[model samples]
Target chain A: MSTLKNGIVCSPAIHAPGEREITFSQAIREAVAEEMARDERVFVIGEDVAEAGSVFKVLVGLLDEFGADRVIDSPISEAGIAGIGVGAAITGMRPIVDIMFGDFTTLVMDQMINQAAKTHYMSGGKLTVPMVLRTTLGASRRSAAQHSQSLHALFSHIPGLKVAVPATPYDAKGLMKSAIRDDNPVVIFEDKMLYQQKGPVPEGEYVLPLGQADVKRAGEDITIVATSSMVYTALEAVDKLAEAGISAELVDPRTTTPLDTETLIESARKTSRALVVDEGYQQYGVTGELAAVIADGAFYYLDAPVKRIGAMNVPVPFSPAMEDLTIPSADYVFETAKAMCG
Target chain B: MTETNGTKQNGAELDAEHWLQAYEQMVRIRSFEEAANELYTSARMPGIAHLYIGEEAIAVGMCEVLRQDDYITSTHRGHGHCLAKGAALDRMFAELLGKEAGYCRGKGGSMHIADQETGNLGANGIVGGSAGIATGAGMSIKLRGTDQVAVCFFGDGALGQGLLYESMNMAQLWKLPVIYVCENNQYGEYTHNSKTAAGSMIGRATGFGVHAQGIDGQDIRTVYSTARLVVDRARNGGGPAFLVCNTYRFRGHHVGDIDRPYRTREEEEEWAKRDPLKLLEDWLTKTRQADASVFERIQQDVQTAVDEAVNFALEAPFPEESEVERHVYA
Candidate 1:
């Protein structure tokens, strides 16, 4: 079976028979460790990556394993870090550059969008900028507006970049490994909230392809398309919807760039209704794009208009209550899904 | 590569060989850029073309000191640097014409030209764009344990850019094998460097303690000598050097920009007094490296080369519309 449709093991700890549970952090660590062990050319560079092993601790123990030469700690220069990553990538090194926060992508936009994205095409296919710009994005930790953002849509819009948003531990490790090996520039948006979320990942060498979507729950009433941390929220909403006699299918798009429109279209066609959910701003975001694609692909099969449920249009505030108000909750998802089903 | 006597100041006693190479490179740039200007004026090439008219000496000086394997990242006004770093004439011309045979396969024109084989990272359209790249190349060299030094060429306008400061700091901290060559060509688009910049360009480097120095970029010998010391130091694991070469742009910021609104004719005339070509020609004649006939011969050769490039570009095929989508991914 294709890795995209891998059987979702419910409750990572309550694994079936011989399965093992792993967090999103452990999966990513294993992926990096495996890739580093496999290829001597691969290395990680970012702020606090060496001694600290990154602020999120996703790269813990890597410095000891790979040594400082491979796991470099960069200064707080987003543009420089990005440019250095590009330069090293085109020359020889397979660099996985962590930008710390997705909000800082604005600071390094010239290098990421202008230099890294355009290098391969600008060089007449004579050079390949094979690298991954990894960043953690979300508003759960109350990082406020500056530190939290879901700007994968901005990167996905760029022609030369491949955007990957892995919402599960299984997909995170597999997709990261795949991104590292791929010969084009890839941007991996890791949700900060899902780092501790547990799931079963294969022990041996495994890789998941980009631009693939996974169906968590199969239902006939309505298909709920969710991204990143919102996937779990959709699963929660699915459970709630089922209690109310509304069978809602949960579709998690692993990679949002080469968006898995086919699977979504098929699901929308079958269910005859769709609800797109994301943590990004609803005005111009992944939900908006996916909703359009779903409509274009299966417009006639639709029982009602496509609904886009996302964060309220406001910067993620500091207070827990205010932040909670801004973020989409399970109740919100249930209400949207219920309305669609009704 | 014969060395001049240490006794001669600024290599004034240079031989005919060095004179012709320097003279030829400068002539090549002057001729090529003149052709590009005419092409833009005639509407043959339709894009913003930043010509490197008066900044030939800096590119030639830096490239001469660098080996073919060494890397150099350039700015938008980078045709001179590409030619100096051994970019193919026909390919560059083809790129400017948006033909299939171009350096960017016509995907990138004048502002975005890159020669990978020759180690020209790219001519970035963004100001101060090459700093991080050059530093990264230095990191690669250090990791690979190679003696290859990376040189980044940008204008004086880039001196105010934040990336330059960050890159210089990193280069100093790690002692990366990189050379930061700032060709301060007086203007960053329309504003004068003095009007926009607060302090000296050399201080930008010295503050980081990166062995900074300033020079008259019109004098090719001084430019070459300073670059040689810096490049040699980096190759031998000395560290990064931030050398500021003060040059002037005889042309406007771009092909079509008439600088009458921002700059003055008198000021242009004043700076033209120390034109790099004249300085080199005067030195060559005084040193008896070449007579009038030899100068004419070298100019003729460069003219012929430029003419050949134009013809090749004119005859080259434009990229197919279907192929436009190609290379966007890889």
Candidate 2:
């Protein structure tokens, strides 16, 4: 078994051995594979999951490894898929359901919102549903508005759910592991752009606890809180801002709900300024909620008004330049932080 | 596969015990509903109560075929279901009164009454919601290798729900040991069945490959026999069956609809004339089977039982306010 170690960890065979390199897709595949092997109840079900693997090839070779039953290739029915998973989970099965695209979650909103989220409470706590719903969100490939929407904000608004939007390979593996094991229903939003990006991931089984924020970079002039693909954008913008001599602290909230609001609050209290970044639509987006939480939770510490950066209050257009203009970018984060600090 | 002789045992051979049980249940339901109506109109009860006055025989006939441990899923029209499933009158009455001593600690009122020991899953208020849940219960039984059967009680209006179709298909696909009992009370709320339903009820079940039948629900004997055959088949692993009990409601959908003009008096009178309670009574008296003294004794017994239940409920205390957040998580 090829073992790869980073920092202080060691485990079985990884595609990237002895190298501090693992693609985002490889990280996800490793997490699901290890989890399914560890737990008897873990199984994957989604469209094109078996014979063709996943559309993004993140689930490649899983069908051959786990057989057809565990890696189910379901019919193209999102509602039925989600509904069956809800039933299965309530009846003592842990299903890792894939909705292919985050946009298609709208088709199964009733199953997600009504059944999975409320069954435990509505049944007067007679049931405990353990299931992880994985969907790819965000757009950097010009997939257009229909296939490229970031709707995690909608799911985060729900109370009974736990939302995880991982930004890097290490966080992807760790957060996915945490999500799979969490008792509550978890929606793991994986950005499409981050899938092919490479980063250092530990070789062995690890769980990055949900509801904790990671300080990706440490600086005291300004605080930048970003999620999903925007974390990379924030890091890039920080590099350019460093050349321009504007030091900043960057925080990546690996999970949204049960958000690491404490970390963001502490950082805002120290820096006295915050720039919220997200890829969702402008109104009622994650940035708006984070800004509000900061305003209410740590208003006295703020030296300047909290700035928000998100997609335009419109659909994500198809053109490359327009798409960049639409979604919050590192340039946007940098610009907003600069203006706030100035 | 042992076969016994289908011999006739006096007039009782035609199910005298079963009919007697049905009559007892029908009588109990009628008295209970009447008492609830009187109490509700007087504002004695806590919440809106859906009386099962006009739909007595369906629950009685269906429950008669079920063993004490066999499960049944009820709807908002659940008083008859709880009573038929052998739930304690005191607990049920206490539940209706939102008392602490009630079945669900009075949290689940009339629509959500439940008695787990009796295998009466809580009465759901959502249309067709119980179908899949009952199917899940059947799955639970099958997985545990038990002979227990789950009876899903749904209104005719539930037939249009997709979960109904999805559950029916799943039940048939697995040959789940269940009985899908559709209580066709002729109306869904204010709308007539003719206006809402598509095709025949039997057709809907048969289309899903379940053995389907419809019986005159007002007649306890017919309901008992048909239910016995279907329920027995299910118990012995013959898969699920759909039995649509054709019946009617004598009173308005709820207690307050005294002036609704949706249906004619002729229709109501036609159904009321064949009330399951009177049908059993006529059969019993005509055959000189039960005397006026016996009937009076039965009436007194049921009335006393209902009175004791009401008194118990009235004396029962309300649940503590702290219990609200207690059951939200397991």
Name the docking class for model 2. acceptable
Alpha carbon lDDT at A170, candidate 1:
82
Q: Among these predicted structures, which one has the highest DockQ?
A: 1
List model 2 lDDT by residue over A207-323, tens digit each.
889999887777788888889988878887877777778888888888888799899998888888888888888798899999987777778988898888888887878999788
Off by over 4 Å in 1: A1-16, B1-7, B12-14
What digit string (tens of lDDT, one per residue) describes model 1 on residues B1-330? 233334567755556687689889999999999999999999999686888888899999889888889999998999999999999888999999999999998988998888878999999889998788889889888888889999999998887799989888888888899999988888888988879889777887888889989998989999988888899998988899988888889999898896447888898899899889989887777655566788898899889999999999999999988877788776
Taking the candidates in order, what DockQ does each have? 0.77, 0.26
- Winning candidate number (TM-score): 1
For candidate 2, the share of real interface contacts preserved is: 0.11
TM-score of each: 0.96, 0.82
Cα lDDT, model 2, residue B115:
69
- Which residue segments of model 2 deviate by more than 4 Å? A1-77, A95-97, A140-146, A169-183, A197-205, A316-324, B1-39, B60-73, B82-91, B94-107, B113-121, B135-150, B170-179, B219-243, B280-305
Residue lDDT tens for model 1, A1-342: 121223342434223446687999999989989999998878888899889988999999999999998998988988888888888887888889889899988888888888888888887888788899999778878878888778888888887888888888988998999999988889999999889988877677778888888887788999999998888888889888989999888898888887889999999999999999988887788889999999999999999999998888898888887988877788999998898888
Candidate 1 has an lDDT of 0.87
